[model samples]
Target: MKVVAADSSSAILNEKFDPLTIVATAAVLVDSPYREARGSLPEPIYADANKGYEVIVHEAELCLNLLEKTKADVVHLDISLGAISLEELSPIQFTNMKISTLGKQHLLKILPRIRKIAGEITRKYGIEVLAIGKESIPVRIAELTSGANAILYACEKTLKENQPVLLGLPSKCQPRISDESAYLYSLMAAEHDVRGFAADQSGVLEKVHISEVLNPIARGFRALRIEPKT
Candidate 1:
């Protein structure tokens, strides 16, 4: 089945390697073989890290935006609520879930907006939007896709601001640059071929130098230090 999914990844890190802002969000369409994105829509948000929950609304909107370009059997959201129908999700229904109080409150605040978008997607395209989260391979692809695009965005930021950016990648993923594109490949077992890539049409990769480093605070997560080439 063709699946569309959305996720945000990477971050602008502080001196202490704590994330300050989320760098990019992506929506991808994946078909059978389920290895990589067939098509994708990516956006650079640079949103505050403390307000990370707010990015989901943008992710949903990106999925909707992507649906305009291609057809899909379903849309998967990174909400992680048992693959429930996002269009029908109600605040009353959240009370019984095992989520923490803060997370529940955050979802409650965004439910109306998210449901509105999900309803539109369902009504316009006759496909359901599921809150399947990370368990769905498509969502994992979206995360990698977003992380790949985040590398380009970080390079642009570093060049424009004349400073450096520390980017925290998605868990257990590594980056590879080929031709004019940057790609993030899943390192998790059984996902050997699952990967995502972003084109560097503007040649951002040439303008910056990137170094990989292990995240000191977050195990299993890697980071990139991007700086303008001197």
Candidate 2:
């Protein structure tokens, strides 16, 4: 099945390829300290940087809405427990929090709730929901801040040989080789087609099988030199 791994960092999806299905995935990071003015999740909603789960039910509804808009065939949601918003912390602080005993306790406390939310979304939407936890993730990607990369990687690997996987920013990204690119390129030698690029090459484009491309900054686009299955 053709699948588009959308970068949901924004409210709108901007993928160039058309797929039979779209994948929306994220982790629930409980935001604990918004007042510190230092390291923390964006705001009240620690898990969803853009939208927090005011109530588990509300979060599920929001998921439904997003699915409707994206016309997604399935949703893969990863719940990252005890993961702090380390955006502004020092290296020491980040390391400390990641390994802190208390932090893990906090993560354990909220895991059940996160699972409930995932269940609600699955039941309400009648779509496949792959609820991923931290343990299931690849050690390399799990060492990072979120499970987005792992989710994308799993999606890419699940495809049969010759299946196409569209990779794009799920959220607003830095220049090139951002975390998103790291995960996308991770699937380069896999059994799927990696379709996405920025204005500037991330420097690893040549490592993968990419016979087709669309301009990164162009408004309108048309696929160029699409590679056919062997």
Off by over 4 Å in 2: 1-63, 79-106, 133-230
Candidate 2, residues 137-156, lDDT tens digits: the string is 22112112122332333233
Please provide TM-scores, in order, for all candidate models, with all chains considered together. Answer: 0.98, 0.29
Model 2 TM-score relative to the real fold: 0.29
lDDT of 2 at 147: 24
lDDT to native, each model = 0.94, 0.31
Task: Kindly report which residue pairs in candidate 1 clash with one another.
Answer: none
RMSD of 2: 17.1
Return the top candidate by TM-score. 1
Candidate 2, residue 23: lDDT: 29
What's the TM for model 1? 0.98
* Backbone clash count for every predicted candidate, in the order shown: 0, 6
